[model samples]
Target: MTVTYLLVDGENIDATLGTSILGRRPTPEERPRWDRLLSFARDTWGQPANGLFFLNASNGLPMTFVQALRALGYTPVPLSGTEDQKVVDIAIQRTLDAIADRDDDVMLVSHDGDFLESVEGLLDGERRVGLIAFDEFRNTGFTPLKHRGLQFFDLEHDTHAFNSTLPRLRIIPIEDFDPAQFL
Candidate 1:
């Protein structure tokens, strides 16, 4: 059976949410529902989802959050590195490289550009590859991959993984915009 490997860069998503979109750190209520993401992955491709959430361990693992992720069926990858090392990105890139050699589909949840090469390697068209992120914050490098069959899904808009609405201002296409949503 084909399984969708869902790789989530926890730090990147948080950073983008805080720095780019919200301009403040996300509160617990604002965080994405990881279980929802896994469910979306399963239903989107009609395959089981293997959710791998990667987080920085420089300050030590957040056990409570890790346990929560575990309860949601995610395998939390806590990575520690030197001051300048981006351990989470490195690990996800390597994992993506390994997945590229396999036959199953994969979905990456991050706005980071570090995995562009690994994602490029997986674009052979033999299986589906998707990027799940806030549409306005995705890396431009992945834009070209859309022509090569790299699917894009908005984490909040498409997946509805958050319990409440996020304050995000993105250019909405006329057909997709709904004024009633604001009313």
Candidate 2:
């Protein structure tokens, strides 16, 4: 059996999905269904796999979220620092380096271009590197990675498995408002 490792840049993915699909940042109540995501990855890759979810410690995520991640079989690796410092990126690189010699395939879940070089190096070393991100967000930076003949899976194309029903916005007419009721 071929073991596969799924490394998720949690913040990157959450931001992209929130801005592109949800039209805003996803609230804690709108968290992705982890079981669905894991199932989708397994089906897409055609193999059993392990998942590592990297988050920014500075985000101040609640303990409940951490427990949920653990329950869903995701190992949460949190990096502490501001965004500009590239702390998460560094952690990702270190992780890649640590696992580069392993026989298992690696699937990175992020649209950040910073990983281009590391991914390219892995490909050059004969490691199968797969990128999982929203297709709509793949811009110029992603071009080089694609040019290198790496495989990519767009989450946007697979929303049925990646997103829950987003809350719809509702508008009310001025005449329907009753501000005086509170007084």
Candidate 3:
């Protein structure tokens, strides 16, 4: 059997889902069910041998979230540093490099353009690499990947299954809310 690996860039994915679908950064209480997400990916890719999630430690991600990832059978790799320096990206690159020689399929879950070269290199080396992200989100940075004939999985398109466990966003009545409190 061909081993498959799911690699997630947590920060990028959460930000995309927040801005593109949730209209805000997802709160800890509003976090997506990691199990469902993994299941969806696995089902799409025919059962991955391993799943890894890369998160930036400096973002103040809760330990509970890390535990949740672990519970879903994902290895959470948390890197420490500012977002601008691309520490998470480097970690992902290093991890991919370490496993590049293996004859396994990889699913990369990020929309950042920074991974373009890495993906290209993997494809050039005859490895199967797919991308997963919100295709509707602006600046998804997937043109190069698409041009190279890589497969893509849109998270927004799979909202029915992926969002099944999340609580609905409650809307407050206009009369019950006061907008002048801040002013």
lDDT of each: 0.93, 0.72, 0.70
Put down candidate 1 lDDT per residue, 1-183, tens digits, no spaces. 889999999989989988987899988888898999999999999989999999998889899999999999999999999989999999999999999778999999999999999999999979999999999999999999999999999999899899988889988999998999879
Model 1, C-alpha of 171: deviation from truth (Å): 1.3
Screening candidate 2 with a backbone cut-off below 3 angstroms (N, C-alpha, C), the clashing residue pairs are none
TM-score of 1: 0.97
Q: Note the clash tally of each candidate.
A: 0, 0, 0
**In terms of lDDT, which candidate is stronger, 1 or 3?**
1
Q: For residues 1-183, what per-residue lDDT tens digits would candidate 2 score against the true structure? A: 566788888778788768866888787657566666666667776888788888777768667868888899888887788668777888998887777676767888888888877777677545567887766575447666766667877654453443454443323348756677337
User: Candidate 3: RMSD over Cα atoms?
Assistant: 8.8
The superposed Cα distance between candidate 1 and the true structure at residue 90, in angstroms, equals 0.2
lDDT for position 160 in model 1: 89
The candidate scoring highest on lDDT is 1
Decide which is better by TM-score, 2 or 3.
Answer: 2
Clashing residue pairs, backbone N/CA/C < 3 A, model 3: none
Give the candidate number with the greatest TM-score. 1
Q: How high a TM-score does candidate 2 get? A: 0.76
Better of 1 and 2 by TM-score: 1
| Model 2 lDDT, full chain set | 0.72
lDDT of 1: 0.93
Off by over 4 Å in 2: 28-31, 59-61, 82-84, 163-183
**Could you tell me which 10 consecutive residues in candidate 3 have the lowest summed lDDT?**
163-172
